[model samples]
Target: MHRQIAGKLTGPVTKWIVLVGAIVLVGIMAPLNGKLIDVQNNEASSWLPQSAESTKVVEQLTGTVDPNDIPTLLVYHRDSGLTTADLAAMDEDAKEIEQIKGVTAQGAFSPNEAKALIASGAKVPPLLSDDDKVAFVAFTFNFGKNGWQDIPDAADKVRELSKIDGVDVHLAGFGGQASDASEAFEGIDTNLIFITLLVVIVILLFTYRSPVLWVLPIISAGFSYMISGGVVYLLAKYADLTVNGQSQSILGILVIGAGTDYALLLIARYREELRRHEDRHEAMAFALHRAAPAILASAATVVIGMLCLVFADLNSTAGLGPVLAVGVGVTFLIMVT
Candidate 1:
């Protein structure tokens, strides 16, 4: 059965058809592959399980508290005691910060406000340290569901506005951390793909010991990656599958790594068959017949293992399983075809 299937797949007309069809499918899916990053949800809450205490609290507070509100703290420190000029600059910064689109005016406190609350004898957290060497401003930003994506820009604007001549300014709190994280994940997909491809190419060249032969597996891996990404993008965009930077990065590595492994196995078998059979196409057919069962079994094992991740409590982990399974499954199909 395997030999018959392999023979038909490698047949002159059918083989061209499969090759052309795969190339066209990849071309059609190229746009979707590029858009995978857009649907990624990197917000911390997205990673938490729905039943988690924090997730539950967030849901409970949805009506009373603005779930989108992110508390941000801007801290300024001077080795030398903050001068009059520094205090004045902070006051100006407060005014400008309030003008930022998402910044909440209510409950925001700057150095000047702290001084008034102190004079009024109202108990409030000190804006300035006892030594007067450090001060901070507090504000809230509410940018709705996609607020995390906008945080880095907002933080940058705040940093620009709050610059004090002699004081060190730092962003601290949830918004700050979110901004930092967003920055860290930026360009993750591109960087990971390039690095993965380069490493795979180098390793393949070393393993195959041919300058040109390494390209075939790399091309196959690239097709698998693109196809998997496109499928994942569709799932996330329409089916509401959660795709994060972590999962997307993992998908690229998994597809490339798995595809390369399968290619090596199939090619090794083809090399052995070549010496015994004069016809290259017949040799390939025999190689595929012998190798297909092992490849199918290995891919099935990996796909099943990844699917088990669906039971994980964390949303990210649950989502990761299907994402990886799709990648490996796609790699298997592309490699054998």
Candidate 2:
């Protein structure tokens, strides 16, 4: 059964058809790479269990407020403590932020306001630290709809507007974290793909000891990664699959690693069959017959193990299950083809 299957698959007509089909598929899916990050959800509530109290609060607040608003804390500090001028400058900066679209300015303290509160015998504004060396201004910025894609832009505007001379400014809170994370992930996928390719080429060159032969596994792995990415993107878009930076990054690595392993196994068996059979088609048939079972079992084990994460309480973990299982399954298909 296996030999017949392999013989049909290796036929010249079938080979060309598969090659053309693969090229067309890749062309259609290549544009999806840029769209993946746009669909990603980084909200803390997305990852937590629905049963958690925090998650419940988030759910309750979603209907009543701008649930997509991210809080930004601007901290200004000076070793000598803020002068009256610094406080006045901070108030003006806060007002300036209000003019920037999407910002809900809050809790800006000027020296005047501070003095008035003190004179009124009310507790001083919490903006000033006890040491009087640091003060904070806060704002909530709205990112309408699927807003994480706008976080980096919003953070940049805040950082640019918060700058004041004679005082060091630091951005804190969720908005700041999103900006830092965006910077870190920028170009990460491209660099990772480049490094994976380089490493695979080096290892394949050493293993095959033939310049022409090393390209085969690399091409197969590349196709697997692209197809896996596209499939995962669809799942995330339509299935409420919770993918964040971490899972998306790992998906690329998983496909390349597993695809290479399967390719090596198949290529070794094909080489051995070539030595024993005079016809290349017959050689491929026997090779796949001998090697496909073990490869299938290995891939199935990985897929089942990964899919078991669907039982996890955390949405991120559950999402990773299907994403990686799809990656491994696709890798297996590309290697065998």
Give all TM-scores, in the order shown: 0.90, 0.89
Q: Predict model 2's lDDT versus the native.
A: 0.80
Model 2: how far residue 171 lies from native, Å: 0.7
- Residue 210 of model 2: what lDDT? 96
**Candidate 1 deviates by what RMSD?**
2.5
Off by over 4 Å in 1: 101-108, 114-126, 143-145
lDDT of 2 at 270: 91
Winning candidate number (TM-score): 1
Best by lDDT: 1
